[model samples]
Target chain A: MMIPTPSALAYVPFVSVANMMRLVHSLGPEHFLSELAAYIEEDFRRWPDFDKTPRIASHSRDGVIELMPTADAESYGFKYVNGHPKNTRTGHQTVTAFGVLSSVATGYPLLLSEMTLLTALRTAATSALVGRYLAPEGARVMALIGNGAQCEFQALAFRALCGIGTLRLYDIDPGATAKAARNLRAQGFDVTECRDAIQAVEGAQIITTCTADKQYATILTDNMVGAGVHINAIGGDCPGKTELHRDILLRADIFVEYPEQTRIEGEIQQLDPDHPVTELWQVMRGTVEGRRNARQITLFDSVGFATEDFSALRYVADQVRGTDFHEPLDLMADPDDPRDLFGMLMRARDA
Target chain B: MMIPTPSALAYVPFVSVANMMRLVHSLGPEHFLSELAAYIEEDFRRWPDFDKTPRIASHSRDGVIELMPTADAESYGFKYVNGHPKNTRTGHQTVTAFGVLSSVATGYPLLLSEMTLLTALRTAATSALVGRYLAPEGARVMALIGNGAQCEFQALAFRALCGIGTLRLYDIDPGATAKAARNLRAQGFDVTECRDAIQAVEGAQIITTCTADKQYATILTDNMVGAGVHINAIGGDCPGKTELHRDILLRADIFVEYPEQTRIEGEIQQLDPDHPVTELWQVMRGTVEGRRNARQITLFDSVGFATEDFSALRYVADQVRGTDFHEPLDLMADPDDPRDLFGMLMRARDA
Candidate 1:
């Protein structure tokens, strides 16, 4: 008898880094971010249905590796990510990641994708999605204080979702600011390269601090954050890594994704344990108010959560279902007879 | 400007199902299992060097998906596995798995491998390695009560590791028994097809029960177990799933992998919480005794641990170092300038 070929169940759709970039470019960055933000917003509205998980982290001397997992009734997703502060010195990304999406019923993986670019996309999408709920009405210009890898994505997502037309960029390195200005200008945005963070936020309604220093540095002090401006603190994601000053957190109406985790990693880590903050999902669901008045300080302690990654995975799985954007990988072993795995191995030698 | 391709750091070595089988056949399964058992035993001897992890699991009505992660000082590894009892009804295996091995210093993945076959290999290797210390000296016969996918591998591993020369097999389904017997006989073993579980264990020096029923099962009664025989009970690995009668456990000197996990999943779950059990690592390290006399019952209540999977990944990574048994996978996004990820994306548009 001839040997049997592997069944279709053995293959999983894998989106490589190249394929992910292709998928993103196929749908323009602005369009992709808008659709992705909508997906995240939909998940946030029904956030009570998700199994919110505490990321399992393995800390080392130089960096940390973490597995963040979440599940809904139909699907389960998890991301494997690492943060090595010194990786930049070696010409490697400070954060790199990959993720898997699986079926909750069968426990079989549906898609395995390069999550590095997807993570950047989803983080930008989430920021814009939250901005829709919390940013000042008619928010036009935004100030970006970190013109690094994520600068352009954030600019694009804000423009797509919140109607931000102009960007003021500032960074410690003039080269980073130039890169952001050059890229944003090429993408048809009115970009201004500012020498200081103060000048960057001069006439902007939204101020985003996304510096990459691993230590606690006051990139945005209390005085720099003006009233009625939405503050998106993206860099203060790990313990002892805050970008905003303590006074900013105390003065602003802080909103967070999964307070249990944000209390440990977000800018709110500088506050007392009992300090009150609004859950972002409740605000998105409309049970709690967001941006009560135009002059109120609204700060989003943007510690990325697993549910956002879940939504990103869901979006990618939907967008690449029948397209030529993915390859079938033999990640699983399927036997001709479920109970005869050894028999199958024996037959492999014959073929 | 020319766009740069992903650097070497962006690619991880991936061993697919075909590659894993090819690797296994390159170094024959018996030899592979023996070497793998040595790797496992080496890890067991210095168990304190490992950062043991509690597996994270997501449970649904019909199935459960789990991520088991562990790290040593030098390397980290994790396996994603799922158990769905009803999957066999739809031509899927009850269990399937894959894993990633990473470098601890950089937090970068070193290898991604299909682990279903590796899991089967490692599980049998662990049992046979434990058999070397616990089973009676010069034992030549093993009675396997569950003759499904795992039975032949158990026989092969035991023979290669401990010099077992004969086999007696039985399963609830006679078809399964026939399959195992045929597979084992082809590989040069004295095989016997038994009428029932009672007939299978008669006069055997090693009794291995590996049924796949997801509920409580009495595959071996109190009287059916003879003294001086080492009982390897593997199927009763989850809560509410056990094979041996309570009386049999009470009479035997039990051994376990990790106390905290085994207390919840192993056969000893039926016993008192404070019941005494020997840690297998301690025995392997010579801190505790394994089997003292020929007349005493030695039961290895095996609940698979994360360290064993870590060891398997380590072994495969080492074995396939220079071989074509793996492929380079574009799993991470690598920008030429680590901080200029957006610039890299923009340049990719022309490429």
Candidate 2:
């Protein structure tokens, strides 16, 4: 049997929200987490081969819009994302994203996906992957602070990747914590609802702060954090937005994905410009140590990088290879004669 | 009776190639050209309000992919474009583009349109808009060098905006020149196909050079370009790619859209870094002189800019409003509760 080639040159594959969810379920959420982690790790292992740049941001009075672009030798990917905390008040997603993965040779898009869900998945996968290296050996309990859209995914990823069994969830809004707890309960997780951040962190070996605040508000204070616990800080991803207290950052050994970007947008932005931080890629590459002593506080200050999104796109492109979950979108114009674009447009009138 | 509000917040309008062609024909090509020229001129008149930056380009071995993003206080727009000279052999456009216009207040995309056709239209509009200021009085004949996809658009734009009725066309490939002549003649232009580049410039008041080559090429030598001709050079838009002879640039008083970008990407790259050049926006804004004397050579270095795409997207968005030419696209994930994105996915699974 002759294998058919993908018509990517003429039609770009698009994975909508419904299709993305179906794809994730088809892979089984836990298996998908591990597979995505592997792709991310594979890219991280050869980190220097890809083009890395801080995301381009357009700031507004209420929120910010950003375009994150990166490319390897074979593929180019970019994500368009918006962060509007006030959007929730108007019944709109606070953070909605879409991405395109394209051929480097042809400069044509191959896969376009709704990245809002994928971003949450990859972020959790990355955090859990880091936890695999940096967390205490055989860690079981995780304190998930600021329970919102990302709370349940982080819980499942940690359970699947880091061997965590219990999730202690807390949010300022009791309704958010209740929603996450209900979701985790359905997924067979040992869920604990806490009254406050301090209560959530008790008896937890891993602590994750994924709040959606646009200010420098601390969800984790220095006193609440103890030694030997891994801190996954995902909320402090833009200028003037930080989750951990400055004192907590001073106490921890910081590891980051792209320190140049992390220093500007991560929790490290609160510290000195010259504050030493090891790149997570180096640790994943095994050139640098992840966890040293029993009492060492290893903090992953992840201001999400483009490579992670690229990996997520790679995952989606792979999962939907021969499936019906994706549809082709005629996003680019192709003509019989490249120089005859006007002729093509003119002929469209007859067609 | 209750009035219905536009469902803009729920759906983004998408203008496909068929729809864009229909839109162009609906307004009649010449009238559409004049209206697009007016929009381009309006944005140029208020150029200071725009957030201008050189396009972010990802250069490959064969070509380049670029993202041009810009924003005003109320609206944001961006274009994804690519240039692959060798793509024509594979039946693909050398230049393919798409763009999005969004609300700055909500960070929601309002319109997504294929920019391949709009780009051609706006490039012609901008060229003609500039020719109106720089071209000599009673200019009726234009020398169109390097006739390619942009050839006919340039021809008609000059006719609509600058009162040019005759076109002298020449290309290295006679087939391309023939194609352009055939297209222009059908549009009622007095088209004359010239034997060589030197022959094409004879008795022409305005000259447009729009070849697609990734090299330092001289389609117009210093000796070929006479005084008092407004040269619209649109081909040399990347690093190490220039169309005019360096000596031609020495004699011409060059005008550009953005000096910071034009110095790096336009024909002026061959000149001194601090070489004095006038901003075309300033000329349109009445802050600088356009044509000082009849004998002075004026060259408009037209490397495409972000604001022109902004204007094109703006025009398409306006023209397609309440019309069937554009269909609503569910490009964004608009959940009922922004914080409950995961819940939305779960609900979709059930539905």
Candidate 3:
């Protein structure tokens, strides 16, 4: 049988960094986060349908590169990401990412997208989605420690998803705190710049830490976190990198995206291997309890997972359906006769 | 410290299928094959330096999609490939591939290229390279039992690398044999088209079987393969797919790329679990002998490996150094302040 020659079918829709930013702006940040949260929650509620595996990582002296793959019955997705904390010193992003979505039936890629911006949006959405379930009632204030790339996204996602109206920001670098405070003030949020993590947590109902370090520095001490507070920990996402003290994990009701991954790369990595932690999917599925009482501390030990990236990909693929925000990438080779690949190359010579 | 904004450095060089074919033609097929053979040999001699892993595959009812990743001290490479045996019936390729080469230190992709043509080239280069050592001295004639997409390339590679002057082509379909014969005839090789497998191996010092089927079908039987003939078996690449009869395997001294991989997906799968087989790398390194006698039957059980793909990517990255065969793909996000990713997004509003 003769196969069809090259056409648009051979091209995958690719969302570049410029297009991603344009799409995010076109959708508006708050609305985009809310919609992303909805997609994430829907996928989490059906988490059992996914083909899940811990990320395959290639580590180096300065950083780590990872491939996170997941698939369901209909579609497959994977993310290529890197974490190089020292990259910031060289004027490079500490974290950069891209992803692909493919059709499981035909083994063809459907979408390729820049996930650096999407990852920030989705991580914030996931925190906000889980916060709606675990955060205390009438939670209107958040403590955002380590004011870096992910700080402002967290503040806005919490505002859009959980009705959070104020942000208490802190960073080891005062310049970073000032930058975050300035950005949030423009977004119409009541912003507080704190001198230390202790001051950032004072009188705040939710605390989010997202520092950029490949070490085990405790951003939060056991004494800093009070009862009835929810901790959204995002920075401690690789081995030997953690933000919370082990004693803090003991006093909190821990929630994670995937326990197998969190045990190796999340804040819980500092704890015992068999430490009891509830999966956020179980909490979303209503099969397990999230927050026990008003006096209990809740922790969402957020090490990223493949499914969330898959959700973000699916979201972008869905949103860009009728838009020109994507370019077709001529990535796959299509020959007229599938078995006549040589003939195809020969014909190209004549052309 | 403030980082530089996005620029061409964030763009990866992407070579499309058409560009790849143009490259092959510009370099001349025979010379390109010889150069590829050299690169493959150089990488094989230092096989211990590579970080190797068996491909990760996701299988569906009709096919399988796979990711093969490998890295050395300086560069990392991976190929995204698919195998759908039934795709030819519906006007699609049974195998299509694309690959990326990245900087290990920076975690930045250096090149992205269509690997369909490259895979065909690399596979043929590997077989010819191995045949130079395993085939009997002064072997000029080769029996190409499956005259399909890969047949012409194999014939030319053998001509370039092993000085083979003649090709005897055969396939179940007469049209496929005609296509390969026509292609090879234009390349100035003395070509003979045969009716069946038995007639194909007549008076040939080398036998190459590369049929496209996903079953345990015997394309080569014991009596058809005589003594002193080196067989290059290519198409048996998955768990249940094999080409040669079990009896022929018993008589031939087998050489494989990787034992752990070949044991699961090569012609040697028919043998006992502990049956002895020499690694081709060892043979290339001169630690193990190949074709000890003129009367010995040597077989190269070829199930493509990750390092070979890495070599191909490295070769392409090297060849496209100062050429315009590739377009710069804006794939990475570079923010002015590495920690001010949200600010970057916010500034996009003014632009």
Query: Which stretches of model 3 miss by more than 4 angstroms?
Result: A1-5, B1-5
Provide the lDDT at B173 for model 3: 89
**Cα lDDT of model 2 by residue, B163-222, tens digit:** 999999999999999999987897899999999999999999899999998899999999
- What TM-score does model 1 achieve against the real structure? 0.97
Residue-level lDDT tens digits of model 3 in B36-127: 98999999999999888778777777788888888888888888888887887877777888888888887888998999889999999999
Tens-digit lDDT string for candidate 2 (A1-351): 212221345467878766887888777888999999999999999999998888889998888988889999999899888888788787777787888898887787888788888998999999999999999887899999988888888988898898898999999999999988887888788999999999999999999999998999989989999989999998999998999999998989999999888988999999999999999899999999999987999899988999999999998999999999998766676666678777776666555
List, in the given order, the native-contact fraction of each candidate: 0.80, 0.58, 0.70
lDDT of each: 0.90, 0.87, 0.89
Lowest lDDT sum, 10 consecutive residues, model 1 chain A, at A342-351
DockQ of 1: 0.78
Q: On residues A1-351, what C-alpha lDDT tens digit does candidate 3 reach at each position?
A: 233357765788999988998899999999999999999999999999998989988888788888888888888898888888888887778788888898887777899898888999999999999999999988999999999889999999999999999889899999999999999999999998998899999999999999988899989999998899999999999999999998999999999999999999999888889988899999899999888888899999999999999999999999999899999888877777678888888788777
Report how far off residue B189 is in candidate 3 (Å). 2.4
Every prediction's TM-score for the first chain?
0.98, 0.97, 0.97
Error of 1 at B68 (Å): 0.6
